[model samples]
Target chain A: MASPIIITPAQVATSRDGEVVMLCLSGNWQITASPPRWEQPALDRPLRRIVLQAAAIGDWDSSLALYLSAARTWSGQQGVELVEQGVPAEVGRLAALLAPKPTPPAPQPQLADLVASVGQATHQLWQETKDLAQLLGECAYSLGRFIRGQAQFRWRDCFTEMQQCGALALPIVGLISFLVGVIMAYQAAVQLRQFGADIYVADLVGLSVVREMGPMMAAIVLAGRTGAAFAATLGNMQANEEIDALETLGVSPIDFLVMPRIMALFLMMPLLALYADFLGIMGGLVVTASILDIPSSLYWIETKSIIDLSDLSTGLIKAATFGLIIGLCACLRGLQAERSAVGAGRAATAAVVTSTLLIIVSDAVFAVIFNILGW
Target chain B: MNTASGKSKFAIEVEGVECRYGERVVLTNVSFAVKPSEIFFIIGGNGCGKSTLLRHLIGLKQPVQGQVKYFGRDFTHADRAGRQELLRTFGVLYQNGALWSSMTLAENVALPLELYTQLDRRERARIVSLKLAQVGLAGLEDYYPVELSGGMKRRAGLARALALDPAIVFFDEPSAGLDPITSLKLDELIRQIRDTLGTTIVIVSHELPSIFDIADRVVMIDSGARGVIAEGEPNQLREASPDQRVREFLNRRVAAVQQQQGILHP
Candidate 1:
């Protein structure tokens, strides 16, 4: 077996000989190592010529060609003639091959360009907002047609989506709501014990979970899970030209794809929220019974006494609104996605983020409206 | 570049190769040697595993049973570093151009140079422009792949593939979605590359014009036979081959052109 050859780092040194610059290259010029930067030799006289001597160079690759090209460029800039002496024929040929061609200069940024770009971005955002509004209006129109038995999507697909966003989501929703219940009850127990009002832990856990946490947590979970899925599915369809095929076949994607998803969330979200409320209360009962020594029957009675129909209805209404927001954001982002794999990924991320934001904002709006209504 | 044993006359050598997907065998006992600077074509009808064979040659997929040698070194059994060394000499142009959608044409072409060379930014840009110009895509460096038409995109892809001046260039269906004139121009470019630079070219295509215009030798794989059924110069094979399938595959375009001319004259 042959021993491996040791590679010396590439080096370039220069000397001034009369009006000519003597450039000597040594060592290996392989791509694995960085090449030394070329600097013009300092001379007091006007340089008439640059001579490249590469006889000492070991094994070489494209890095050598690049270095030689740099020397050629420097010679051009200094208006000096470059003469190759003993440079490998292949490297010399490569250096000549990369001879600088005239190309458009990189655009310089200016105040006008900045202002134009800003205006362009604003115009694009406005266009996007208008498109989203149009999509929502079309979705509403599709729903109306669906209710009238005239829409195009299969009932089986809608049921599948419902199962995806509803029944399939129960385990995660139950887990989150139950943890919320336990934490809320434990915190309330800490405060109420100071006032000798430990029984109120049940009221606090029940009322809060029913009115806010149950629906809000459930909606946020669905936004991350179902909304992202919807966006990814439709975005990939759009990327694959499947959506275009549907349009060509006289089927509106909004009717076939978006409406079914929206309908599934609409009917399933409130039911999920109600289920979450029960799980959360059960968690509260367990915490109170263990820590406060309250009987399960006593905790249940206190929870029933504090919670009313208006509170349950308010949570259900907010859950329904959140479902709508999630469905709209996801479908809008999917339909707006560009025809590429990266675009589909961006759509999924945007769906989760947008739907989650809208859910919180609408929940606050619901709080304000409910406060005014005194329900 | 000579191997440790000695220089191999062939640029690429495939011996006793078998290709399969799970249980389905696609090609078996496929053996061929591509000489240095030869324009080699792998031609077959639809679903004959032409691309599968190309994949094996490029090391995209390993053959179930065979040795693929590049320059006398075993490529299929080469370790990661060994394979990387062999791959550096390869330039592949996929059917759809496969230009990175996020990058401009200049960036697409410059990526290989950036990764493999220590050239400064300015020199890199110069090489990029030179390559783009070589492929007739000069001055459109700022344009994205989506902004260009099909022919321009393919040209941009060619520019990128030639970025490193690879010794071997593999093209997958170079003429697939192109108009006749554009496809012919691409064929001319392939011929020019081989004639001028002496780069070995391996192409997987069913395009008759491309095969006839540029291929120095051709290998036809048959789906039914599950291996290469014919190997020779395409024109000679069309005229003189005993295999009916090879003759039919190669002469179909000629027959069509003659029929068209006859109809016009009549």
Candidate 2:
């Protein structure tokens, strides 16, 4: 029969040897029974050593090791030595193994480390730029080959990409364009009415929507939607070594993989931009007629008088450039992706960021040039 | 030479390493070392973290504790120059034979040469052919990975891994998805590559036959122990291990075959 665990301070007595303090423990040393608390030995006492009287320890488990470990720690802090011989050999070994090592302090970032990281990042950026330029050159060469009927890509692929990039993008594009136009007209009406100039609201809405907002909004939507899709598809294929297979087959990946998608987006963006212009104008017309108390016929007349062929052509041109940017960035990032699952996701994110940035920068440059030419 | 003491001249040393995926600890307290030109095999049951250990050694992962070293230099803590030197010396063949799908076999072989070496186009092409020929893929240079059989894809992947004449190569489950005959051929090819190039090869596989045939030394991990339970020559472990768990694992196939025979006869 197993004895019940019992721990009492009275049972802990000084040994016949004056230097030792002994703890007498009986029965099962399990946490299920309340284990005895071992007090920290007094530093001022003549206690030079602490020992466990484990002769009565029956059916003990890890709780015994924990209690011994606590006693050892307390003894060490009080300049008292813990004699391991008194404890069961198994308990001693277990306590030693389970002891935690002191953790080292975390390293602080140094100025030198910061400078080195900056240097590394700059070099990486320069390398990426060179790679992107090389990819663009290769893509251009493939396009030339395509024009001369030398490229091997199927016409069916080009048409499929076109349908996916353009037709499939319509609903979201239409909804965004409508909301943008409505917001623009609502904001413009509040300002125009301040001077009783509400009649000029159509001119502001028509010119801004046709020349800038329509194409820019449409390009942003596509950058997030179509550009990310292209990156994800090609990046997944790259991870699976599908891209490597194309190279090994003596096929130019740009011609076989990228050319079709680029051609589709390049051909479709201007048409999509024109459609967005119509939707945005209709949205503005709804706000103008209902909120501004303007007649629908007069609103159309005002819009027609303010918008011209130059404004429409400029927006279409911008749309084409944005399409080229999105296609190039997406394909380049996808091709450069590492061979892993997370790598494909990272490539898609990079494609969206690069396409969005390039679109905004190119748009600014175009605005400056168009202003100079008075387009 | 004891690797834990940091006194051995080892090609790679993995000491007291632990691997975890999120909340689940996969492996713990694992330690081993490989010498130069040794064919080291890691064998384990399903989900025992054999591939995870390989990834940690290849620098694709950081161990939750402990460290991996290449010739006394810590892999994870190494500087960029040290890492580049390590990469240039190492080649990896992933399980699925990750050849770029868009490239021809010849072009795939030419890529690392183009990136890391200054060899001209003709020289690069010649080397590509030589490596392909080494893998018995001499004339199929224009074929894509998608067009190849499972064994052929692994062979092509091996060819690509050897492109830069790496000092060490790692293969993950090279016999997976291959028939017995094809797997035997692959084992022979792996031995040939090692003998000819004198490259240290680290293979993670559960194929007992291949392990016995190709491994200079084998380490068997236990999911229950959460660490390696046996380490020795395959024949030595099969014949002399005192642990019943090790004996059971080594004789598992024989026991299965006997049971099948018993069922058939009865």
Candidate 3:
């Protein structure tokens, strides 16, 4: 029997006691003769005792399976005695394959190896890949469930979500867009004055603010404000098992929990973006009127002419799209959040990342479609 | 028990239910019935089909092979409205207590009412405060779940369970991680609810003390191949002769190590 390629941490907890037991490769545990080359020595040094653990691994996928297979085989030949009772799951699964015990002892059970089983190291790899695929599928399925529940949603909950998206977020949206407008107008003044095309600054400000800047700024602000807020709120709920609780309670989580949030963003975002557009243009109007000595009436006339219904509609459409993506991503990340305190931070970060990425991608798609259609 | 309402007369019948996840078979050919108004306890080690069995009772999981009937209704396959109708008559307390952390105590307690009922906000507030008070969290209604201790959160969760005045309440594990004192208090609360409302209760627990304290009859599941090995009043089973599995379970020992006396007395 050749020694299987097993590289485990030199030590592992093999008993139910709080004590950590030692594993001697040659004496206590040994390689066995098997076609698949399990670590068990089937004929002579029948693997008398072993302990398996899930997190205690020192090898990649294949090696981990072989090590587990070896432990399982060795245990099988000897009726599966254990030094690691209440064994961790990874080890528990491995031991289970051999012993076939209906009620397998837990990885940390007192009789160290008393019917213990553990998973192979490959299980972690399997879980990570599986979880990602599962999350994506869950997202799509959740949306399907979402669409069905929309009609049945309680209007009051929608009001509460809209209230938060509008009332609570207004201050931040107003403050930031106001600041951005101030900066844009200041930047436009410096650049336009240099070209002696100072009067044409109206064209530049009106077109940019109405068609692009207004909606873009609004979406970005929301991504930071409401987007982050949605993710954090939902993430905390996920960590606390509130989502699962809702399901157990016979509440349609989508109608009761999500519809209001989506509705809130849908209503507030475009409205806020429209407000930002007006404020942003006024900023440019003020700067031009004061510094360049252009009359306020002239600035207003030029803005009205350059910023038509099409320009305003384009920006509003972009704001609406961005709103959906930002809110969806935030809530998705939140609902999919992890269980730890750090998971909250991670969900917030993921919400920001996913929202920003969606924003840019969506903007690009919108631009192309508009250009093709000559909007 | 008051016995004022016959709601406690509804029984939970889990018949020949089978379920599997992909290739892994989690439950196979399992069956049991929970009597009305009596605390029925499901006791098993982890992964021994304990939670899966509970899901069936609550219509969370539909059996592929058989069905679960709640008071003679075809519950396992019921639609949302049907399930919702059935749910209105009962309460469920999950294994983790599943409180929404974002909402305050009062808000969380009021959620179910807010969902299915048309009570005004003030009315909701009044009922929420009353429920919280029942759980000894009266003034703490504004506290978030994170702000409260584990025991407090569980109590708040209990208040939410009792929010709608259901005819029965189901608990996943009423004393999982709390200290013994808190666990005992929760048990006493369970007893009090039963005494007061005479509500039919189904509890899933492995804690021996809790089982002996609140459960009227304990159903013990041993292995996958072995269905239910024992089902009787906890005190009766504790005193009566039992199979080796039942005896080991009652004594909280490793069943495999002990041999059956096999005199056909059990």
Candidate 4:
């Protein structure tokens, strides 16, 4: 018998449904198209070997489009054939638009995309700055309108806020100031007992309450209680978009919202400062009476002699400035709020903290200025 | 602009109104007027200057150029007192409904009356209950707006708007992000408010369904259109406009598009 004829896989030209598919020596090449009409008939003879050559003469757009159309469509369904590991440069551009580019031919991060991202970040920063600027400008303009418009309303709100900020807040203020006065008198009594100057405790309590304890306690109380409340209220308003609602209501958030708070705090702060002084003095009276055994008559006599109106007025001025800074910062931050509720909280906390900082810094500056100017 | 003084008596007027945020131009020379007691709806795509334009009418945002007027008083030019006096005639129901979280619904409704009106506390409470009843929320007076549904919050806002018995009420995107049934209820409430209150209502929305169901006149403000391309009753708008955007917007929204589509003829 004649030796059986062997037709190797390479020699075979597979026709899919009778459309001629040229196989290459590499075993990877195959003609891809939409399942073609399959007009090409059977091969002339059994193939012996395969050779590869480019049949097309022109640009590969039509070929790429054909393959991609098939690939896109087949990929849309269940894919049948092996796709190339990476698209040809021609196909890559087309694929970029139609789908996310596949991995392996990783896209180099372009200078343009990086530049675009940087530009976006810069634009965002610039927008934030512009927003902050506009917010501040609006606050000032609104305050000016309020100052001009809110004559009676400001006083009313100030009185009401004073009750809220000062009278209602008095317990905490009084308690803390009282304790501080006792501590001062006790500390003085300890040191002075050895020096045979025990009665000087009355002078210590009297002087401290008149000067530092009054203003310092008042500032501390407002910072903790009133300042925080201001921040929280403003912050909540900011969060709730109530400020935006005010704007839409044609209510100048600054004028209608901020001005009342600012003016309220302004008027209230001095009254609060005075109340704090009275309570502080009362605290000192208790300490002087109990520890120093100095009578109220003597304590008041000494306090009146040393504590002039300027000392009181200086503290009052400082409290007013402190109130203004706290209310202004809180309201400004409130209006600067974004959508989230946390922003309002941050704004409120910031108001309290910022006011406390201002209270210190401004107090020192005012002290120097008043000393220099003889106010 | 001309009709603001003439026989037409524009209830609301915007003339050459320009608004911007930093460098980005939000609106450019948008000018239009709503007639007295008219149900005017301003419709546009997102970020297409709908809410911004609505804000200008109430003096929330001061326009960069020209003016927004109500009853011939320039809203932007007016001082706070002037604005407040002007504001007395209109109520704004903001996008969030702007109910105070700290206050209950009764307190929220009673606030404007407390601040602006001479109504006694008991009287204000009665009025608040009455307004809440009018919005189908009579029993929910004690609950906060926070506890209410989106639809309920809107209704509560409407009640608050009616607190001072204003002549006009402005709604900002009333149906946005709401379920269909809730949106439909709101649409009915809005129409009822107009028909019963006899109040001019201006709603800024792109929600096509609610806009057509209630708008006595729809003001279509596409960016490409010079300003407002179509203005008339909801049905008349579809027939009057040759613009494709207007037709697509109107025809689909309205039920009788069969005639417009020539479906009936064929």
Candidate 5:
């Protein structure tokens, strides 16, 4: 029968002799055991050399290498010679691997570099603007081709996109518009009640919901949902070489991929805005009935009287324009995406952010135009 | 001593495997056995289910109707834990290397060792260094996959695949994107790994020089036939295979080069 060998804890002891520092490493130096702590010897004396004595060291692994490398680094920094005595060949080799290699320093930016970067950024932005305009022109040309029945457009794909852009979006659009209606009606009720004119809450909610809130809310929601999806899907296809495959087969990506999505959104956005208007008005009716004691029939009659064809048409037209903006921004970012996973993610984010900004800016422009035209 | 059809002698055995995606059948009635320490090659035309068959062999996808046995144990029917135990012995190199873009080469190689072994950090680092050196990628351990060239990336991926000293290594189009010299070097490395380690190797490739250079036995799968059309030594198949398609595929490069030279010279 063999006896079991007893294990020993690792130890590091430091002693000074003249200008040389002696680091004594002993006992088992396995990583499973707790490592020994050794404080740095004082630098008061001019040290010429440091000796690592591992004569009593037992079975060891990376822990010993780690200790030796630490000593080596300290000696290098202190401008002293390091001497290894009786160390195993394996430990020496492992310790050598731990030695740090020189790396090139990163360049620091200067004033001229900053100016150059700014100039480069401006040039990139100008180029991107031109690309966006060219994409829109290509889309218009493909639409012309479709009208003449000469484009490679699939009705099935267009219908699928319509379903995604319209039907699947209803629940969220309905929810947000309904909440907006409730908030607006509550604010209106607070003020109108002061004058005992609570019945006019119907007129306020109806006009605003139909003219401004409905199209804006629906467009914003679709910008985040459908636009980001378009960018991500196309960006991934680009990464996987599927877009290149389509191009090699003589198919125009604008006619095949972009046209269907844009047409779907253009046709569906007005319908979605109309649906949102109805839901928002219904929410206002609920609030008015409960808080102001107004009957649903009376609220409906007042709402109908206040909201004319002009208000409805204004919201629908804004919605259609917003839809076009979202589609163009998203598809352009998708087509322009670099072929990588990170590029796909950036494309999706850029699509959502850019489309939302454009939607708000276009809505402001429409506000000015409508005001000037006295619609 | 021998029972149950003597399947234990072979390293891998596939019986009547059928591959399909939904209702579209890709391959049917595929059957083959690979002996221990053999270098086998699966060759086929583009989009001909060579990759699909490789996927089945590696237990990535289940065959609709058939059995895949690894060392006489049914891999297709193994439970999660049992399948993981079986998978630990296998290493697969994908067509594009597919090294994690975020990790450095050393970290990529160390991942499998960290997961599967109880080796200490120093020991694992030593093994990682050795494997990279074997693949001729030593001293570039800190380089990320995106920083390396395509050939270097593939070699690093091979190093990672060999991290655990797997019993069987699978290569999918190992020479797909490499120059001829680099691919020939890779073929040499593959043969060296087999000879030194006695590891079973199964490669999926259509590169003709690679097929003839390293393959001990070759199987040709035809897109139209939807199964293995011929199986034998590459040289013998070119000379004597009854299937005209097999002969044409094996001798395609020679005729292609000759016709190209004729056109250029004329």
Candidate 6:
């Protein structure tokens, strides 16, 4: 059906007349088998040129070209010239098409490079901070305008975002908070049991759940969930030029895109935090009745005595702060994302990381402020 | 306008095809056939279903009312593996290049090669370099798609599309985002690919310069009619198209060039 190809190893024979090395190739060099190893031969005399003799070669493709290129590279390294006069014209053209270009040398660094890089990073940070502050100021202004019935954002969009951030987050927040409560009660019970002070476990779990773990856990979950969603949605819109289109049509991106999401997270955070606190305290009650053999009424009385209106208010305050952090971080990262498809994924990851960091840092600050005020 | 006579010599045949996107009908009663190794162009204004037709032809979408035969084989109903075998015989370059954002240019080119061919890594890399160099993008193997310019990105996309050396290559607006000089260079590169490799080319473009320069035969789609209104060589259509709209679309470029020269000299 097809022409059969003859085979042999490549043999380089040297002639004394012109000091040329002729490589005689005979085979089916059609990329089916391994190529012949043409080792660089040691020459006593000055090598003038290396030429390929392919008169006995059969059908071929890139295999012959790769072999020729390797031979050329070897000859060039040995300071000998490779002449393509005897090879087929098609193989020559294929070899020439794939001839590798020499790469440019890398630039040398100087002392000014370090100074310029630091200066550039500092300027970028300052510019970004300024832009973020401007966005926040505009959002606040829009909020004020809305209070006076002048803002252009839709109330329906705000309600929709609120619904997503609030209702959708309940199950996850409930699961994680209940687990955290169980862990705290279990750990505290082992130590408190040695002192015959099992009732104090109720105080520990209830006070911490209401004051710290409730708000922090809810904030972190929302940071990973709603905040990331916000970044990806807005980043995709930016990449598709929809944000630009909105601006072209006399709609402010801040008013149309950012405000609704920010309002939703900001207003929904306290409610979600309160619900987490209830689930966490219930988890403590479950562990108390099952593990510590404490009466349910006694545990409830101890929890009620330990938690006051100030403790509840402190957790809500942290929840509200964490919500602002998540909302702002998501919006900032998304709006500043590169206008590309890949940038949307990066924006979502950055939003989650930054929101978690800001939430924790601000929660610590709230703890210190509330401690100093003795709340 | 159906120009093909029979299916024996045609590499691709589309007959009585109708395509819709949801409730809106985009194209209807479209029939054409491309001879083997010819550079064919599909040209139209925006929203004229040039891309929709391409999707149907490439087996990505099924037409509502007709059949697409590839080499006399029914393509509209080919199963998964059958369609994959069919796809191995052709390549497509989408709008925005659509090179994977994660991989480097070399890896992107090597993707289809790795999937379809039995070439080893060393040979695959060599072929990658050759294809990139073919598109005038030598020594840019390690660069990511995001780092490249629009023209370089398009060239990288072309390199990836040509990785498998398919019999036919489809390009969706290859010169859409390029400058005039870069667009001309792209037109020349497309011609070189067709002539050098003898690969059949089907291009969809709205740009007049590219349509006239590289197209051996052109099909004009109009959204108002929801079908192909004219088919011929671009120059033939410019001179002898019976439809006024076809003449206007082709003649507008001549008018723009003449007006530019007038503004420069007078």
Winning model by DockQ? 3
Q: Candidate 1 on B171-264: residue-level lDDT in tens?
A: 9899998999999999998888888788889999999888988899999999999999999999999999999889988988445555543222
Judge candidate 1 at residue B11 and give its lDDT: 87
Candidate 4 stretches greater than 4 Å from native: A1-160, A171-205, A238-241, A244-313, A369-375, B1-7, B72-82, B102-104, B111-126, B139-143, B223-266
lDDT of 3 at A118: 36
Who wins the TM-score comparison?
3
**Model 6 chain A weakest lDDT span, ten residues long:** A242-251
Question: What is candidate 2's lDDT per residue for B1-266, written digit by digit as tens?
Answer: 11122344897888899988667888998999888788999988888889888877776667889888876778767785567566666777878788876569998788778756899999999999999999889998999888999889999988888888876788999999899999999899989988987888899998988988999998999888889999988889988988666776776644455554322241
lDDT tens per residue, model 6, B57-143: 876567999998776767788785566566666777776666666469998798777656789999999999999999999999999
Among residues 3 or more apart in sequence or in different chains, the pairs in candidate 1 whose N, CA or C atoms overlap within 3 Å are none
Summing lDDT over every window of 10 consecutive residues in candidate 3 chain B, give the lowest-scoring window: B257-266
Candidate 4 residue pairs in clash (backbone atoms < 3 Å) = A231-A348, A235-A344, A247-B60
Report each candidate's C-alpha RMSD, comma-separated, in the order given: 22.8, 14.7, 13.2, 12.7, 20.8, 20.5
Candidate 1, CAPRI quality class derived from DockQ? incorrect
Badly placed stretches (over 4 Å) of model 2 are A1-42, A52-81, A85-108, A111-124, A152-157, B1-94, B97-172, B176-208, B211-266
Prediction-by-prediction clash tally: 0, 27, 30, 3, 0, 0
lDDT of 4 by residue, A56-79 (tens): 212244344344444444434432
Task: Calculate DockQ per candidate and list them.
Answer: 0.02, 0.09, 0.31, 0.30, 0.02, 0.02
lDDT of 3 by residue, A139-205 (tens): 4565576677634366776787788777776777666666666677778888888988777777887
User: Could you give candidate 6's per-residue lDDT for residues A192-268 as a string of tens digits?
Assistant: 99999999999999999999999999999999999999999888767754454333223457876788899899899
* Model 1: per-residue Cα lDDT over A1-375, one tens digit each: 999978899998888878988889899888888878777778578889998999999889888888889989988988889898778877877777677988999888666677888999999979977877898899888878788976676576789899999999999999999999998999999999899998899899999999999999899999999999899888877775456433422346788789889889999999999999999999899998998899999999999999999999999998998899899999999988987989889999999998898888888888899999998
Classified by CAPRI criteria, candidate 4 counts as acceptable
Q: For residue B5, what is the lDDT in candidate 3?
A: 32
